[model samples]
Target: MAHVVTAFLRNRGRILLTRRSDAVGTYSGKWAGVSGYVEGDPNDAEDDARRELEEEVGVTEATLANTAQPMHITDGEREWTVHAFMFDVNHRDIAPNEELAAVEWVHAPVICERDTVPELWPTYRRVAPTLETVQTDDAHGSAWVSLRALEVLRDAASDAESWEVLVSFGRSLRDARPSMAAVTNRVNRVLADAAGDTEALCQRAAAEIDAAAEADDVASAEAAQLLRTEGYDHVATLSRSGTVRAALEDAGPSVLVAESRPGLEGVTVAESLAKKGLETTLTTDAALPGLVADGAVDAVLVGADAVLSSGDVVNKVGSYPVALAAARADVPVFAVCARDKIRGDDTVVGEEGGALYDGDLPITVSNPLFELVPSDLADGVVTEEGRLDSDGVERVAAEHAELARWDESTSSGADAGGDG
Candidate 1:
């Protein structure tokens, strides 16, 4: 069997699809991701995928997001095995070689309608997040997961037979990450605005995905401004928050990131910030709070999994101690996130994780994925709408509550139709 690699380049919520030139050996004039024949052992497929991306689209630098198992396809007497890879790129500029007739960055669902090579949609599905992926994801923050949930709905809506089925899909996405208020709030907004229409729902889901991304951008900008205006030269954070990274990039603050245990997401964050030319320091989770108490940190900025109506922030485990240390040091602690993360209630749902310790000793090991930092511990909350006061948080929470009512409204409509 012949082995080949296909790399999907993603930027700003779209995938790059290239139209193969007629001069290519096979699948000429068909839309496909950056692809090429794999050289050497299949175990080294990722290197071949990167090499193809550089040759096909002039993309020399990109973060590998995912890889799928090899898919076998039979075209005539030739058997071919396709290896799929996905990359998240920072820029959209592309220099298409002669092998590509044209290139366009489009939503993944659009691939379904396009005349493409064999199993292109299936290959994309392998890299994209499913409901299960969203639920089990530990690498990304809630804001990131919420946007991915919208993408999941967008793809599902394309195949849904009726409005009822679409609603069911949206409901499943809304409940996929219970601790992620942004996931529930954003999905609810799309469902409520669509109002039981499939086409409208699809359109709204796409629009909301863009809006949600923009919201994070705006919130990051707001936080950056806060950092500059307040003269917070040194900031400390825990875990990996995309918005937090963006804000630090914009503000150019010296950063100390705690190595969020088990996952060590903060190591990734610290490396990313350092690459962006920011002064960065990596510390163990246990050392971070002490560093804050030593006045090494001017401010503590974190991304929220949920901002409760009571103004408390639910974030990755180990945030509370940092907040407490910041409070003791009189350093301002800010929770940064889009307004969609604000929940209508103060109830915090905790996710239990698998035991980290496996031994013959019968001691229980508790691994909670999240924890709550009381509202009093936070100095302020920064959002796209600016610094939100307690009243503003409550107002956003009320809006969220109203958006959540779409479920009741849809269910009632279905019951009324049955009665009719």
Candidate 2:
């Protein structure tokens, strides 16, 4: 078996198809996209795709529009697992090598309609949408997670080799967005099952991640019920939590969404709630304190990126102030998070980013990823295991840690940051 890369170079709605020269070793005179054997590190498929395009058609300045999961194809006694790529090119001029007889710019729709190499259409179909999903510039939070997870699931298999591939894929996604707790939580959650029988780990991991993306499932319903029990009809939330959004949707409460600064993720949350027909109010972060002080909000319900063992929550930066205001105004603050988000007590710190404006100014802009909401300020925490008070959070955290030890015979070891 051998690995290879196929790159489709597109310009002005047409893709370049090269006819393999009769002098080529195999598939001579067949219409195919720019392709070559995996000559370097297999993981660097994009580089290989670009290299093939340059070597075959003499194009070098193309942008990678999409990359797809590898597709395994067997032709007689030989097998090839092909990595496909789609590139958007600025120019159409091509210089065919001795290995390529000629190059034709054909419309993408009619590629399969022409005489072509074996399994070309199947390879294209498998890799096309991957580019579309990954190339989406505006996907954020859970939407991004869901899209990436599908790709991960597509690559998952029930063997050691497959598990390694999945783990590598998960790690890549996690590294792409370090500030996103959901990414780490979902990745780590799936990886936890790796030590067990991997017969269905891929499917199981995909199912778990899909449920996490949906947000409005049984766990959220339970959180919603807790809100209902508390008689909260108008809830205020800063930043966005898929879990919080689900709970708000299920509870059917009017929502006050703070314009989460830096990222403005809160605006997205507010828009989503408004579209659901909820009386959603979009306000500035400064106004949240006033809203809580005026008792305009029934309670402050938020989401946690990481729920620490000490019961402190690592959430969007402005969460601390909102929780503080809620406490001062006698408004209960609850963090709607799932049990998996209870990733072991690691030191959670707010991150600083370019969202504060990248100017050549002599002033410092503070853009932290999240701030700690001390356990005392957060009156309760709602997870799949049910609602836990400040003391209950510690109890649950310790219990969950013990359970994890029994499950995996390992401990992430609690990091001391906030009080228990």
Candidate 3:
């Protein structure tokens, strides 16, 4: 029920505008950004954003961030909420889409000084604040988000219909109540800027922690500080999250085991569990049926790359079938994750990472880092707050959405991916 749009601005003080090629839809003849009234389309905002951006300015997912301004206005009896975004890109050859006579790069402030579309001006003013970009990236080389991945995962999350994203978000917030807001704020701010590298991320985290500390937000600030420190250690190979030990501690007994894919990640899982004093039975992809049919296991725990709003998990290639097997056997399948992996209510696990796949280009394929496992198969989700149900997840998420403050340095969603 809202109208959202995006304006891609370049750092050289130029804003990209598109003129009306056809005059049938809203504001046909006027110049606009990769702008459009949001279809209010569930689970497809990223896709819509990407499509519009490319159509208007010929850019790809690796060029924008999840930062947009909400412009609320009323045109006669019509009311709209357009989220105009500021996207920066280097200057390149421009091929104006027939709608406009010409395209030029002008200072952002000049948009007001120049004689341009009347309606477009107001949109710029309101959108500018939202586009102020909480974090300023000096590097400004290149930036991007998993536009397509976000689109596909959001669709799967909604279509599953068995789980709602709010469940997990609420769970995170509730459990981490004191510090959630600050954490999210910091993380969102980092994301807004073009700071994707490891150093920038840590710097962002440290800044957030300092902010929290100043605000006297001890719990979250401390968490923020921890992540910044730990995250830096991880990237620099300075510290580790206990490679095999953690999995074994969580798996309990190896009987309820399923291997992850890509690099047979399950080896990490099985080895970790074995070290942790569990009866681990490591099996291959085919052995799933025999084990489940024979009533061999009581539960399953798998790692994930991302989680959708509808409680569908995007895990490794083998994860989906494991979930299916667990469901058929009436056994509970749980997912173990740390606080950094949590993105709002849904994990954004498989989304916003990269082109689904990138190994062999030219023949580019979508290499989603995970698969969707419906909530029905998910017996519970384990996080720092202990095991949470779908509803418990709801509460935790609600509790933390406002408080789960993350800085730029953490929650990179860098560890895993799923099958496309």
Candidate 4:
């Protein structure tokens, strides 16, 4: 199969408009959006969006989704289901980069009036309508909260006054690290409960996580080795033996890749895997298929930042691409994560629907944090309890739905920068 790639680009509004640089192949300078070539792996749309934005416009990881949408477009014979994102920019001036010959923002009507690839027109026109609908849908409206809505919920959860909410939020951060603010708030909740005071919890938790960061806080290196010896196996994880690294050590030797980014999760995972006596081979974002073709990979056991309901998983920016590649290769992909990552609502089309925008570098940037992998992309989910399929996602969610204290409704909560 050819590259079933996705793109993330700006249009109307404070659009990070630019002429596509001919530095790369394919559509060169004909004025297309930020595009990516699929590495014959699973397509993680949100992450691709983030990566495209960053690679093209030098966006920081802070503000990637001001106006983001998951859309598919046909470019002649090639078909790409891209996550089209928009952001507001107040640029004093405009300039082009290596991938973009120029960058600018214009009015929506004028943008709509411009000539385009023609094949992508329908997908482009739907952007505003899609954004409007996804933004307005309330938390109670549906189970799958659009990506934009997730940001709102994270904000609401962060502002929550209840200690349980805060602690739960903190556990969310540690278990998933989806949103730093949410995690901080949750950590504060834990400290607040312990100290019986709301003040100064953030300062304290940081201190603890930092100290904990030094010495295998989740699992001692010795303990990790013991777990590895005692029928536990480690899979995909950060390079160090934190919680994720420990899990990979317990599983040992997974078919992995080097996840590059503002934060390189794969570098950490690869370095650690080598230490654990695992047969780990690092590959590029594009070489996934070749490995699969060679039959070198047995299964995909990756890590996650959060696992949403409705069977969608949020992971590193590159994780979705890897999963998409794996899925296409007919290899089963299992996410090795704790149950705590299950967000307020899972069914919400997390990354596929929502995106947030924050200005990074200058006024031009897109720093997407998480990619949404639908249950379909996953062969199974491996938790501490064991491995389960996407169907089990709904089962666990439904079981939790009965808990009167838990709200499984569609969350109007904004999910900006909520991803790890």
Q: Name the best candidate (by TM-score).
A: 1
Which one wins on lDDT?
1
Q: Please list the C-alpha lDDT of all candidates, in the order they appear.
A: 0.91, 0.69, 0.44, 0.45
**lDDT tens digits by residue: candidate 2, 1-420:** 799988888654356888898877779988889988998878998888888888888887887767878888888988898999888775678888889887888544345567787788666656543323532333244334443543344334322365445545545654454444455555555556555435455555546644654443655787899889889998998876767888898899999999987678888888889888999999999888888888999798887767777888888777888888888888999888766556455557454655556778787776676788888898877877688765666665554454334223322222222233
Candidate 4 lDDT over 1-420, as tens digits, reads 243323434321223344556686666655555556544444455565555656666663423333444555665787665545444322223333587665555322233445544344344444432323333432211112222222222232324596446545434443332231123223323343344222334334333333323322232343344344543332333212134555556555453555454445466567756777777767565565456545556555555555666667766556676676667767666655544345545532232323344546455335565567777887656554455566666565544334312221212122332542
Native RMSD of candidate 1 (Å): 2.0
* Model 3 segments more than 4 A misplaced: 1-186, 189-247, 250-252, 256-259, 345-367, 398-420
**After superposing candidate 1, which stretches have Cα over 4 Å from the reference?**
74-79, 360-364, 418-420
Sorted on TM-score, best first, the list reads 1, 2, 4, 3
Q: What is the lDDT of residue 153 in candidate 2?
A: 40
Per-candidate TM equals 0.94, 0.59, 0.37, 0.40
Candidates 1 and 2, the one with greater TM-score: 1
- lDDT for model 3, please: 0.44
lDDT of 1 by residue, 180-254 (tens): 999999899989998877878878888888899899999999999999999999999999889989999999999
**Best to worst by lDDT, what's the order?**
1, 2, 4, 3
lDDT of 4: 0.45
Each prediction's RMSD to truth? 2.0, 13.3, 19.7, 19.3
